[model samples]
Target: MGAQEDTALVRRGYEAFSAGDMDTLRELFTEDAVWHTGGTGALSGDKKGRDAILAYFGELYSRSNGSLKLTLEDVATGGRYTIGVQSGRADRDGKTLDQRTVIVFTISDDKVIEALEMAEDTAVASEFWS
Candidate 1:
């Protein structure tokens, strides 16, 4: 059940994210799911949760002036595992925000328990993360 549900969750989550559907993505997460990047990478303890995850992105998307888009280039699936290649551009002042990301997700009981993301180009992403 873990692997099956995890596969479904991963596929749908990325599809929703690619469409900027935060509501759908939120539904896939556990109350303590973790989301982070940069110096704040992989938040632990209280920082882990659905509410926290949503709030984190809410603030992040707002900073981008709501011009955030992500597309999954490819996905590899295994028992309780998924890896995806993603490309996205953030525009807020007629300028693009470098956000090429490679995301890894872990799901349990049909809900996401862990979400990890890294910049595909560490250098370019480092410039954008801050």
Candidate 2:
């Protein structure tokens, strides 16, 4: 993929995720795309393939009660690297689930090959994962 295509993929993926558009995200990942949340219970480990990504996003949508939205803090793309910081509250049952994270994505051939997430604090992530 060209530089423009790579940037667009990253932009679209992040935009779709922010809008909770699971359908669009499904088309942006490889069959074995890995999504790691550093052990965050809401998102973690290898969510293999487009199916898994859709399922995980579905879980978020349901659990958040439609309050699950991402507002990107920053985004930078170069070659196969895209770094994005987003903050959102995953709300459910009138309770708010704070999920402020910075995600670094590795893209290949205009598809997301890998995603690594870092919570606002590792200690907080540890507790959430636990």
Candidate 3:
């Protein structure tokens, strides 16, 4: 796929994720996809396989009580890689989390095969998830 197509695919993923649409997310990812979250918290680490990635997403919703919101700021692609920037906020256990994050995604066969997420403030994010 070209850069535009790759960007579109990633945008759809952000939309699906924000809407808690697991089915769409499942379709957008490869079966052996890996999602890596950077931080030293409970929610941090590599989520291998589509199932594990979905589970991590579920945990985000559960932890925030469905209050998590992600706004896609931008998407840029080069070859088979796409970079997505987003701002997010959520409330959990009386703590409020407001952050910006960037995700580098590797696409193959029109599906996401790998993702590496970088948070604006890892310490704050870790505290919120911990």
Candidate 4:
């Protein structure tokens, strides 16, 4: 796919994620897709496969008591790589998390094959999710 098409696909993923549409997410990612989250938090790790990635997303929702909100700021694509910038906020265990994150995605055949997540404030994110 071209850069525009790839960007659109990623935007669709962000929308699907915000809407909690797991079915759409499943369709957007490959069966062997991997998602990487950095930091020392419970949610930080390499989530292998589509099922594991979906479960990580579910954990985000459950941990935040369905209060996690993600706002997509921008998306850019080059070749098969798409980068998405977003801001997220949530409250958990009397701790408030408000952070910006950038996710670099490797797409192939119109589906995401891998995603690497980078939080703007890793220490704060780690504390919040720890």
Please provide, for model 4 over 8-102, each residue's C-alpha lDDT reduced to its tens digit, 9 standing for 90 to 100.
Answer: 99999999999999999999999999999999887898999999999999999999999999999999898758999999999999989998999
> Lowest-lDDT window of 10 residues in candidate 2?
121-130
What stretches of model 3 exceed 4 Å from their correct place? none
TM-score for all models, in order of appearance: 0.76, 0.79, 0.98, 0.97
**Candidate number with the higher TM-score (2 or 3):** 3
TM-score, model 3 to reference:
0.98
For model 3, residues 6-26, the per-residue Cα lDDT tens digits are 999999999999888999999
lDDT of 2 at 73: 72
Candidate 3 lDDT:
0.94
Model 1 misplaced regions, further than 4 Å: 2-5, 18-20, 38-47, 93-95
lDDT by residue for model 2 (57-127), tens: 77667765666777777677776678877886665555555767888888887788888877787565445
Error of 2 at 8 (Å): 2.4
- Let me know the TM-score candidate 4 reaches against the reference structure: 0.97
Question: How much does each candidate deviate from the true structure in C-alpha RMSD?
Answer: 3.4, 2.7, 0.7, 0.8
- Candidate 2: list runs displaced more than 4 Å: 2-4, 40-43, 122-130
Tens-place lDDT per residue, model 1, 1-130, is 5555556667798787667788897788887787655433232223477888777677557766877777777777677567777878886545576656766777677787776777756555444444
Rank candidates, lDDT, best first. Answer: 3, 4, 2, 1
